[model samples]
Target: MTIYVLIAVMTLALVLLGSSVRVITQFERGVVFRFGRVRPGTRGPGLALIAPVADRLQKVNMQIITQPVPAQDGITRDNVTVRVDAVLYYRVVDPVRVAVDVQDYGSAVLQVAQASLRSIIGKSELDDLLSNRERLNQGLELMIDNPAVGWGVHIDRVEIKDVALPESMKRSMSRQAEAERERRSRVITADGELQASRKLAEAAEVMAEHPAALQLRLLQTVVEVAAEKNSTLVLPFPVELLRFLERATPPETTTAASTAATAPSESAPPTAPARTNGAVPAGRAVYPAAPDAAAVAHAVAER
Candidate 1:
């Protein structure tokens, strides 16, 4: 009977020892509640001992937690509808407060993040939401951190994951971008044309000062066109050469036979003789003045 009682006592002690021991991982912290009240300080990693009947040990994770907030739909300040979602990075800074001050710090942080995101969306314009996300992220972190600080949770960072705009808005943005590109193209083309016109005007001045340059340019153009090996080649005749010919050649006298050939037909009425020295001469006939040889040759060449 003595041996049985000793065996029973040993079993009970082993069970109590096992129940009182708690293992805390390196990434976790142990919080104790004694008699329904939290302990003053937290226990660091490793083993912890507590009374089985009078104390409770709760392990709190100390590592950073990544939480993804769901998408929130809201209207922006510019009266544009949008949907935005984000990710949150945070961790517990004070385990004692985290365990006592908040019932569930993770859930609390998530709720605050969602609310803050919606508030930011409502206060920002569509342009800012799409382009100025860094500023919006900082503002969002401050908003979430304000309430999280009280719960002993520190918000490390907040990031805007994605912003969803309507299809119509997307098309409008595409059109705006296209129009901007077209405007730049037109401006550039106009600038190029203006530069070309200025350069051409300068070249014309140079060519006018040196007439030989014009002849040389014409010959160069002909050479380039001839290199193409085409069947036909057209050459330009310079106006200066024609004017030089006309100036060098003298007028020709009209022959009586040619004048008879050019004279009016007999059916035409005859006019009075032309006056000489400001007086009409008797027994003298008036014939039309002969045409200029250069003019007649030019007219014949044109026909």
Candidate 2:
């Protein structure tokens, strides 16, 4: 009877020992409380012993956690109402503080993040929040991280997900952007005009220094106009024509032989060149004081 009683007592003690010992996972740490007081530190991932009925173990994951915050509608500094949402990355650094200092660390971090977002939005303009999101996220993380230290949570990062704007504001922004583009285009065109006028003034000063350059420029202009296949090309001349006055008495002044000797011989009268007609008229012919007979003959042959 004594051996049987001793065997029963030993079996009961072994069962209690097995039940009090816990094996922590690789990614987890055990926070042990002995008689309502937390242990010195976290227990290892392999094996941990706790006093039966007096010690309790709470498992705390050491891995990083991602928590998404819902959209928050708040008024900006510019008095514009907008919806804003963000995500937060947090991790538990100290399990003892998390168990003793806070009731729920995860909920505490989330609530702190939500309040930080609103505080940031209240100080920023709608445009700044919409355009400069990275700045806002950093500010949110800094603000939340400071408050979350007491709760044993470390804020890794904060991310602004979306910002919803009113339709009327969107239309206004588009119109403003279009107007800015138009203003820039007008400024560019005005600059070009100013540059062109300055160049023309400089050219005139240069031409005044050399009168012959003016004549050459006029010829260049004529050539350029002709290149466009214009209906007419203008040719300007400013030379005088001096010819001898004719009298009817010239027939009686000399004998036939003398007249023949004085008069020049003419084999034939040269014909004028016929201009080649194209789709557009090349130009009208303006006569000089005297046309070179050889030139006329050559032109006729070439034409």
The numbered model that scores best in lDDT is 1
TM-score of every prediction relative to native: 0.78, 0.67
Tell me model 1's lDDT, rounded to 2 decimals: 0.89
Model 2 per-residue lDDT tens digits across residues 1-303: 999999999999999999798999999989988888998989979988888899999999889999999899889999988889999998989888888999988888888888988889899998888789888888899999998888888999999999988899889889999999999999999999999999999999999999678878877887888888865664332211111112212343464667689665587666556665654345865544435444444554575
Error of 1 at 150 (Å): 0.2
lDDT to native, each model: 0.89, 0.83
lDDT tens digits, residue span 268-293, model 1:
99887666797647776676654455
Where does model 1 exceed 4 Å of error? 228-303
Displacement of the residue 146 alpha carbon in candidate 2, Å: 3.3
Error of 2 at 189 (Å): 1.5
